[model samples]
Target: MIKIVVDLLGADKPQTELVLGAIRAISENKDLYVYLMGRKAELEDFLANVTYDESQLEIVDCTQEITNYDDPVDAYHDKTDSSLIKGLKMCRMNEDIGGFVTCGATGVVLISSILILGKLNATRPALSVVLNGRNDKPFCIVDCGANIDCKADRFVDFARLGVAYMKTLGIENPTVATLSNGIEAGKGSDVIKEAHELLEKCGFNFTGNIEGKEVLDGNADVVVCDGFAGNVLLKSIEGTAKVVFDDIRRAAAGASDTQKAQLEAFIGRLEPKFDYNNEGGAILLGVKKPVVKGHGAATDKTVYNTVKIAYGLAKNNLVEKISEEFEKK
Candidate 1:
């Protein structure tokens, strides 16, 4: 059985959203076990009689909740008993536990994961995110809001991090590209240009420079960028997806029934393809343990998917594979 710790107190919605989602995940996989971390009183009072296998579920008692406004560092010390911190400790202390999944403030989770689990020893931990790709598989972007300002060598480290991630998804020798203003080698800042040069020599099917427009269309298996650029790119993708989904829904609503049926079928397939929920959330790579962050507005479906992704990461032992790649003495 795979063990994953979930921060039930972290959802932007009622904590019930996260609680029920964890229950749904447990039902989906018999081998999966979750330690739901939150204040026990509210959870039990809300879901005391909910039917579930006793063996698969466990409620870890926690008192505090970390909010988006909390100064992550201060909260790290002051709110030591918060669900986010407690969940990280659960991941670190339990060898049976593989990783943690949280719908909390990303910054707080990032801070606590490092403080609790520590770094992977070779590389500074990075946030690796999976965005919509042209195919069934998603291309991963490393440093998606972790290190805003990064060095050229860190870009190289991000490349290795992205590579390990793609392999776990079963993409053998995933092609990589450095995000740049222009496809020409010299178009970006010195950092990107140098990173490009390094990527070429670092092995792993490194393609040349890739423009932002080409990234989601499957131009590369892994697009490496500093967190500053990656964060902007992630939101832009999210916004565009929202706009497109809205437009498509409006169009389908007015169409004739036959046409609407066809449109609905197309959208049903396309929605999951581009949906962040199905992708779960961005991964915190380069750390000793797996950490996944979902959008704060996550629903029960999104929460369920996040746990599933974490389960895949833990079962595959993704962190250890990453350890072998960069933890060179």
Candidate 2:
């Protein structure tokens, strides 16, 4: 059986909703055994009301939870019993535990992952998320808001991490590219220029630099960038997609019935591609174990998807594969 630890605190959504997601996950995957860490009485009450296999679920009693208001560093040091901290600790202590899933504060998750799980050969962990590109193929971007000021060498590390992740998704010999202002090799800053050269000789299928617009065009299977640029790029794409979709919705509201039907059909087909709930969550690669960070506003459906991803990565031995790749360096 594949075991996963899920922290049910520190999200914008209520605990009950996240718990429901976990229940859904276990119901779907009979081989999955989830350790749900959160308030004990509440969790018990909620579970009692639901009909699920008792063997697949275990609730760890946690009195405290890490919140956005708490300093991530201080919370890590102080909130040892918090759901996020305890859940990760559980993952570390148990070899059978495949991975961890949490809709917790990103800062705390990143810190706890490094401090608790440690890194794969001490390489920096990059947060990566898969997105459906314009060409209808899925692509992943590394360092999406973790390690904001990465050095040039770190970009290369991100590329390897991204490649390792994509390979697990069955993308053999995935093409890689650096996110920059222009497609030219000299388009970005000194870091990009230097990293560009390193990536060329890194032995992966490097496709040179890709502009922000080219990212959605699926120019590369993996796009590498510092956290600052990556985070901005991710949010920009989300924001743009939201604005455009909202405008279409407004226009459809007043359109003829036939036009409305066509617009609704278009949105139904396109929206899931950009939805965070469906994409599961961002995977924190480079850690010793798979750590999935769900969006703060995640729903039960999001939790289910995130747990599925964590389970899949753990089953695939993502950490060991990544370590093997880095050992070649």
Candidate 3:
């Protein structure tokens, strides 16, 4: 059985959506077990309205709540019994528990995971996010928003982690690239220049530096960069998607009925490609166990997908593989 701890008390939406989504997921996968942690009253109240097999769901009472406005570090420290903390603690105690999923503050989740669960080996946990691409394969971006300033060695480790992830997902010999303003080896900053040489020396398939524009073109299987650069790239993609979608919506308004229908269909096809919620958030790679950090404003679907991603990580023994790779370096 795959045990998953879910922090139901987090997120902006009513807790009912999370409960309902969990119910849907559990019903679909009998091998899965969920430990829902949240306020006793709030959780019970929500459960009272839903119909589910009691044997499959376990509720742990957590009176304290972590709000969006609270400082992430302070929230984790002050609210020891917060749903997020409880869920992480449960995962830590139970070896059988595959992973911990939370829509809580990203900072809190990342820090708590590192503090309680610890890192996989010597690697600083990176926020590895899946980037939507034209091909069936999903591109993995490391340090999406985790380590703002990272050393050249860290970037090399990120490359290894990214390759392991892609391999687990069935992509063999994944091409790794560093994000840069130009494709030339000498184009980026001193850090990138050093990272380029180090990655080239590494045994893995390095594709040299990849320009920002070519990222969406599916030029590389794994993209490596410091958190600051990775976060900027991620936000740029999001912002561009939003702008294009808004323009499409406005254009649809002026089209004929048939034309509008076609436009909507096209938008529908493109929407999922850029929807971060659909892909869940990013994985905190290099941890001893799989830890997924969902968006603070994550919905039921996003939470569900996060659970699935965790399950995949555990089943594939991703952490173990990463450990072996790190040991060799």
The TM-score ranking, best first, is 2, 3, 1
What's the TM-score of every candidate structure? 0.93, 0.97, 0.95
For 53-78, candidate 2 gives per-residue lDDT tens digits of 99998999998989888888898899
Pairs clashing within candidate 2: none
Q: Candidate 1's residue-wise lDDT over 280-312, tens digit each?
A: 888999777889888888887777888988998
Output the worst ten-in-a-row residue range by lDDT, candidate 2.
271-280
**Maximum-lDDT candidate:** 2
Off by over 4 Å in 2: none
Q: Kindly provide the TM-score of model 3 when superposed on the true structure, using C-alpha atoms.
A: 0.95
Tell how far residue 135 is off in model 3, in angstroms. Answer: 2.6
- Candidate 1 lDDT score at position 63: 85
Q: What is the C-alpha RMSD of each candidate to the true structure, in Å?
A: 1.9, 1.3, 1.7
Stretches of candidate 1 exceeding 4 Å from the true structure = 250-262, 327-329
Predictions in order: lDDT? 0.84, 0.90, 0.83
Off by over 4 Å in 3: none
- Model 3 steric clash pairs: none
